[model samples]
Each structure stands twice: as structure tokens, then as C-alpha cells.
Target: MSYFGDIYKGIKTLLTGMSVTGKYFITARKGAITQQYPDNRETLKMFERFRGEVVMPHDENNEHRCTGCQKCEIACPNGSIEIIWDRQIDEETGKKKKMIDQHIYHLGMCTMCGLCIEACPTDAILWAQNYENSVYDRSQLTKVLNQSGSKLKAGVED
Candidate 1:
């Protein structure tokens, strides 16, 4: 009797799952939740809050907001972010200040956790919307966020 009861329960559960799938299949033509990729690429849009990749925004003057504080680097759990910095004299204040030489991001190791963005005091880095990050070479995943000859924005250190 118990063996038959187990079989009956298993069949019931299977049918229940099938019914849900059947309903979706029946309505799929009307309004399917599944997206048709490549064909609908032009119409596709990612959500605003989607975390794609980390990027540093530079202004028209090639100035960024990063103060070389290293908070973002410290917040990263996987050591995906590396900030190469050096102390230089600030022309405005005549005081030595930390400036970043390179802001490196290893996309291969990043989990897209957004902790680095949150830890930044100057909002130096944020998520980019471009999600097409596939590459043939693993070394290509390593990116320098800061542009060459880019300097820290004035007053960002204060």
C-alpha cells in the first residue's frame, strides 16, 4: 500500500509541473517571457540598475574624480581592482598628494558585486551599460579604467 502511495504522489507532482509548463507553452505565442536574442538585439535594453562592468568617467578636460584613496581597491573581495599611485605635488596647493597612475580592473575575476562603487568616496567608478565583454584572449579582460594623461579633478582630494 505504501509503495503504491509513493508512486501516486510522484505522478501527481509530475503532472502538476507539466500543467504549468503546458500553460506557458500554450501562451508562449501570445506573449512569451523568453527573449529572442540576436534578432531582437536592437530592441533589447538592459535595466538601469544592471551591473555590467566598472568604468571611470572622465570629463572633457580629461579629469577624473578618483583621489587615489584606494578605498575601492580595498573593498574588492577578489583583488580584482589594483590602483597604481604615486605622490605628486599639487600645483594649486603646493602640497604632495596621492595621484593614481593607473586604475586597473580584472574583469575575469570580478563578480560584479558593486562593492567597489559603494566604497568610493568620490564616485570615481561606476557600472557601465555595455555587457558585451566576451573575448578570445584572457589578457584582454584586464582593463585600465583611467585614460592616459588623465588627472584628478580639482578639489576632489579635499
Candidate 2:
């Protein structure tokens, strides 16, 4: 009957699969193709296309290029941007100006989509190539970028 033929075929298929696995099990000791990860961290390389975390550079003048335009904040679908604005007297005009008070980044919620970089008018933010972002504490993943206590210069903002 066809049923009996199917049973014999199944048994033969099982044996064929077992033979392949047995060969690997016996040959595993010969040499490993796997590259040990942490042991060779110095030589570890990532693709140039990989997108990483965003970073902002603060200058000595305590001025960030971010013009409070909120283009990036608006473009983000998840609303992850938390920009704290503070009023400061513009040194040139001696008038109160709205500036970026603090820029907080929550890495846990970021998708690394690179949308924020394209949305930036001044190109103040960029994706750094360093990708080892693992950490034990979730709170530590949150980064504050304005620690330099400096203002951005004219015509250059990210």
C-alpha cells in the first residue's frame, strides 16, 4: 500500500539526516569556523552601513547649533525627543534668546533609524561608529549631551 511505502521513505530520510549530523559531531574537534567574540574584540569589525547612537558636540562657547527648531522632534514617530529650552542673553544683541537647555537621549527607546540626523537643520547630530552599547543599568543608557556648558557658533548647528 502507499502508506507502507511512505513509512519506509520516512525511515530512510531520518537515517540520511542522522548521517549528516554524525559527521559534524565527529568532525567538530578538527577546527572551529566560529570566531570567538569577546576574545578578539580589537579585530572585530562592523559594516560601514550600520547605524549607531546619536551624539552632539558642545563647544567652548556654551552654544549648541540646535536652533530650537524642533524639526527632529517633530519627525520622530515615537516622540522620544526631550529638549529643555532655557532663556539666555544673546551676547551680540544683549536680548533674551531661546536655546537648547538640555538634550537627553534614552537609548532604550531609540530604533537607530537615522531619521533624526536627516531632520536636523544644522547637522548638529551625527551617528558615531562605536556600537558597543550594552549596559547593566537601564538608567545609565540615558545620556546628557550638554555637559560641556558651551554655546554653539553661528552658521554651524546639527
Candidate 3:
């Protein structure tokens, strides 16, 4: 009698587990409501919480918001940012000021962690919504943000 009761209890537990599995099998046929990645980009809406590419915004006057403080450089953990800056006299005030001599950012090494943006006191660094960054050559990924021909406006912080 005792042996019979043990077998009966085992059968009862197995049936209970199978019942749950069977229920889900039927419901799953109704089609998944989950979002499709990448392909559904046009239909998908990004939330405010999403953090993407880092962009250095230039104001209407062409002057950037960066003060060339080197705070972002110091804050970057991966040493991805190399800011070659020098002190120049502010033409308006005649006072020595920080000027961005050169700005280089390597996308291949960047972690996209937004630490650089957060370190910026003037809100110079912003995160853009573009995420499709694909390049064949590693050298192409190394971007010089500020160049001679296309300098980020003048009289930024200087």
C-alpha cells in the first residue's frame, strides 16, 4: 500500500508540470509580441534612457561649447580621447585662455560609456542617436574631431 501511494504521488506531480507546459505551447501559437531588433528601427521608438553616440555640438555662431578644460580627457578610462590644446589670449578680454589645438577620438577603442560627456562642465559633449558605426579599416575609425579646414567654430572658450 505504501509503495502504491508513492507511485501515485509521482504521477500526480508529473501531470501538473506537463499541464503548464501544454498551456504555454498553445498560447505561443498566438504569435510573439516582442520587438524585432535592427529591422524594426523605423517602427521602434527609442526611450529617453537610451545612450548612443557622443557628439560635440557647435552653436549657431560656429563656436563649440567645449572649454578645452581637458576634463573629459582626464575622465576617459580607456585613453581614447587625445586633446591637444594650448593657451591663447582671448582677443576680447586679452586674458590667456584654453584653446582646443587638436581633438582626436578613436571609435575603435571607445566604450560609449558617456563618461566624457558627463565630465564636460559646459555640456559641450552630447550623445547623438546614431548607432550605426561600421568601418573596414581600423585607421578610419580614428577620427580627428577638430581639423584645420573644418575647425569647430572659433572663440569657443578662448
Best by lDDT: 1
lDDT per model vs. reference: 0.93, 0.78, 0.76
**Tens digits of lDDT, candidate 2, 112-142:** 8888889998977777777799999999888
- Comparing candidate 1 with candidate 2, which one achieves the higher lDDT? 1
Reference-based TM-score of each model = 0.79, 0.68, 0.66
Better of 1 and 2 by TM-score: 1
Could you give candidate 1's per-residue lDDT for residues 1-158 as a string of tens digits?
A: 98999999999999999999999889889976777877888888888998899999999999999988999999999999999999999888899878999999999999999999999989999898877889999999999999999998887766
Worst 10 residues of 1 by lDDT: 31-40
Over the stretch 1-158, how does candidate 3's per-residue lDDT look in tens digits? 97999999999999999999989888986866677777887877666656665667665555666667889899999998989888888766799877887778888889988899889887877777765678788898887665453334454444
Q: Best to worst by TM-score, what's the order?
A: 1, 2, 3
Please identify model 1 stretches exceeding 4 Å from their true place. 1-30
Top-TM-score candidate index? 1
lDDT, candidate 1, residue 55? Answer: 96
Clashing pairs in model 1, backbone N/Cα/C closer than 3 A: none
Candidate 1 residue 151 C-alpha distance from true site, Å = 1.0
- Can you list the residue pairs that collide in candidate 2? 61-151, 62-150, 62-151, 63-150, 63-151, 63-152, 64-152, 122-157, 123-158, 124-158
The C-alpha stretches of model 3 lying farther than 4 A from their native spots are 1-45, 146-158
Weakest ten-residue segment in model 2 by summed lDDT: 149-158
Alpha-carbon error at 138 in model 3, in Å?
A: 1.7
Model 3 local distance difference test score: 0.76
Ranking by lDDT: 1, 2, 3
